[model samples]
Structures are given as C-alpha cells and as structure tokens.
Target chain A: MTRHMSESDSDRSPDAAGRSWHDMGGLPAGGINPAEHDFALWEKRVDALQVLCATKGLYTVDGLRRALEEMGPQAFESMTYYERWISAVTKNLLETGVFTTEELNARMEAVAARGATYGDASIEGASPEGET
Target chain B: MTSLPHVDPPAFPPPYPSAAPRFAPGDAVRVATGHAPGHIRTPWYLRGRVGRVERICGDFANPEELAFHRSGLPPRALYRVRFTMKEIWGERAERGEDTLDAEIFEHWLEAAEG
Candidate 1:
C-alpha cells in the first residue's frame, strides 16, 4: 500500500493547532466497550425525524451537522447524542421557516400540561375518553 | 442532503460532467490546508498531508455550500484519496505500511509531486 501511494514532504501539521472540536479523528480517547443499548422512545423519534427530514429534503445532513458542530463543545459535553441531534434538526427547521418559534413554544406548553413523564405526556397516553 | 426542499435523495443531483478528470489514478495530491470555520467534510488530520488518488469517486454537490442553503450546482469531482499511516502519523504510526482512504472533493485537493 505504501508503495502505490508514496509519501511526500509530509509537512504534516500536528493535530490540535487549529482543529475544531468535532474533528476528533486520530486523537487519543477512551476505550470502546462496544455496548449496544435499546434506544429510548424519544431517541427513536429523533432518529426518525432526522431520517424523514433528510429524506424529504427539509434539510441536508450537512446542515444538521453544521448546527451540531456550531453548538460548541460545551453542548456536546452536556447533551446526549440524540438530544444534540434533535436540537440541530429543530434549529435547521426553524431557521428555514418550517414553523415559527411562537408556535413551538405554544405546542411545548400544551405538551407539558399533559403529564410529566414522556409516555404519559404523549397523546396516546390519554384514554379514548380523555381519562389519564 | 440537499438545498432544495421536498426533493428525494435520488433526485438530489447527478454526477456533473467533469469534461476531463483533473487528477488521475495514482496521482499524488495534497489536501488543501484551509479552515473556513463552517461545515467541512475533510477531516483535520488529513489536511496538508500528501496522498495518492486511489480512484475518482464521481462528482456531487459540495456539502459546504449545501449546508448553508446554497445550490451546490456544477458539482465538484470527488476522489478517493489514499494515504499511508506513516505519511499521516509519522513516527507515531502503529503500522507504517497500513493505508487508509477517504473520499475527498477536488476543490480540497491540489496536484503534488511524489
């Protein structure tokens, strides 16, 4: 492999001089446990939204990545993976005028008034006759 | 991912006619070492490093432009760049002989003498 692709004057600037937080390739990190956990219902919804939006051309994956990357390293440390993704997706949607911030705020308020837990807050959580 | 809304992935954009491919197979090229601070696909480690053009990976819309809601039309030619671990990692390489390849756009590359 080396023979086919010869090396040049590898003025290879070492990593971390001006690199961004998201570009973590070739960097030292912790060992991977290769664990697989079941995705939460909200995480599944976020994933589904990501796929649907991207497929529907509502926003490109690059747009979502830009949102994710621009959110800075602090957000990465604070938020879960899916949480950050949904945040990015929502940002992209809002930036594109898919819906107004006021609309989102109102909808959020409505959702919160339903219940505390995720399953309980969902519409299906309510009985057919509106019983909890 | 696309700039236009409601269009499916299959309808994003076809490979633009390159007319003539710039870097052919086995050509030594270097990834441009520029950081514009926007959505970039080129990894930082590979920037400014020399590599061989393994194969032309066809042309597609530039992600950097598409991310900003711009029509990345007149798609750029994409190539599969190959680099040795030694070339990228220097003395810190686990296996100097091992090579890794990445699909990079033409605008991110320039011709180099091997």
Candidate 2:
C-alpha cells in the first residue's frame, strides 16, 4: 500500500506549534484501522441526546461541528469520538444557559456517589426493591 | 402530548444572473490562505496549495455562515478540486499516483497565476 501522509519527526503531541487539531491532513496516523464495531451504551446515549437537540432546533449540525472544532486541541486528541460529541453538546448547552455549571457538577457528583453504592435502595433503580 | 418539530436545512438563495461562474474545469486555481476567525469548511492542508478544477459541483449554502445558525445567503459555488499527493505532502508521499479530491467553496479558491 502507498503511504502519502507522514508527520514530522518533531513531538507528536497535539496542539503543537503550527498545527491545529483539525489539520490532521498529512500527519502520520500510524495507519488507518479498518476495524469497526457497534456503538457502546454511552455512545448510543450521546447520539440520542445529539439527535434530540437537533430535533428541537436547539443547534444545527454545522453549529455542533464548529463547537467540536473549537475544542482545546489536547482535549480533542484525548477524547473518543462520542466523548467529543458529549463534550461539544454540553459546552453548547452551558453557553446557551440551559443549565448552570454548578448544577451540572452537582448532578454528576450525585450520580457518581450513587454508582459507588451499587445496591443502595434510596437511589431509584439502584436495587430491585426500589424498582418495585 | 408533543409532536416532533419539523426542521429544514437552510435554503439556497436564488441564483443571480449577474454573478456568472468564475473558474472552469481544467483551470488552475490556488486555494486561499490566511488566518480566518470562526468556523470554516475548507481543509487546512489545502490552503495556499495549487490545484486544478475537476468540475463545478454547483452552488450551495455557505457552511461558514450556517455554523452560526444563520441562513447562508448568496449561495457560494462549490467545486471539486483535484490535487496530487506530492503537491499536498511535498516529498512525503511514497507513491506518485496518489491524489486527493475535495469539494471546496469558491470563496476559498483563486485563479492560479502563471
């Protein structure tokens, strides 16, 4: 197979001088991985939320793409595809004042705490008894 | 009870006869270069590179404006630009037959000066 794209010998770190995250043009990507797989649970959730936002006319496809493009290069490089999607969606929501940062953080903390106590009945859906 | 909202993509502006197509197929053109603020659809690698117009792909709503949720007016012409791998990657390409074709908007291209 022919290899046309190759990165320089300099640091391969993202957001390096002279290259933005979106400018992956000729940069070496090791090699294209042809493997494909079904979306994970979280990935599906991200996609559903994005579709919901679009359906509600809360944001356009271009708007979401632009938001993804503007992400910090390091964060963009480190995040998985769906992770980036959720990040962009959350950023848009915050910018539009759909919810405050404090509220988001507190909700995340609550979910984390609930997850720690797997069988805690006080949290709905945490135990079979709670389900009833 | 609620129904799904009907949303349509941005509409294309009616064509103006006064604005004729600029570049033609086989015409040498250079992709525009320089810093631009806000969202842009043009790829960074193609910027400032010279290529040939493969064909006119027709005018469409400008994605740059659409990024901000505005109706892209005065639709921009879209063209398929063909570039050799060497032209884009310099001496980095392993094979000479490699090439890339991208659909670029008219605003991002200029007539290549001989």
Model 2 CA lDDT for position B70: 78
Q: Is the docking of candidate 2 incorrect, acceptable, medium or high quality?
A: acceptable
All candidates: TM-score of chain A: 0.74, 0.65
Cα lDDT of model 2 by residue, A1-132, tens digit: 122223422322345454456767656677677999977656777899999988886667888888887886777569899989998888777866779999999989888887755433333334666557
Best by lDDT: 1
Per-residue lDDT of B11-102 in model 1, one digit per residue for the tens? 22334445456987778888898877888899887887788877776778889988987878878899878887776766667887788888
Error of 1 at A35 (Å): 2.4
List lDDT for all candidates, in order.
0.76, 0.69
Candidate 1: clashing pairs of residues: none
In model 1 chain A, the worst 10-residue window by lDDT is A3-12
Give candidate 2's error at residue B69 in angstroms. Answer: 3.4
Which regions of candidate 2 fall more than 4 Å away from where they truly are?
Answer: A1-19, A32-37, A96-132, B1-20
Tens-digit per-residue lDDT, A1-132, candidate 1? 342233322323234445778888876688877888977767878899899988988889889989998998899779999999989999999988889999999999998887877543454554688753
Question: CAPRI verdict on model 1?
Answer: acceptable
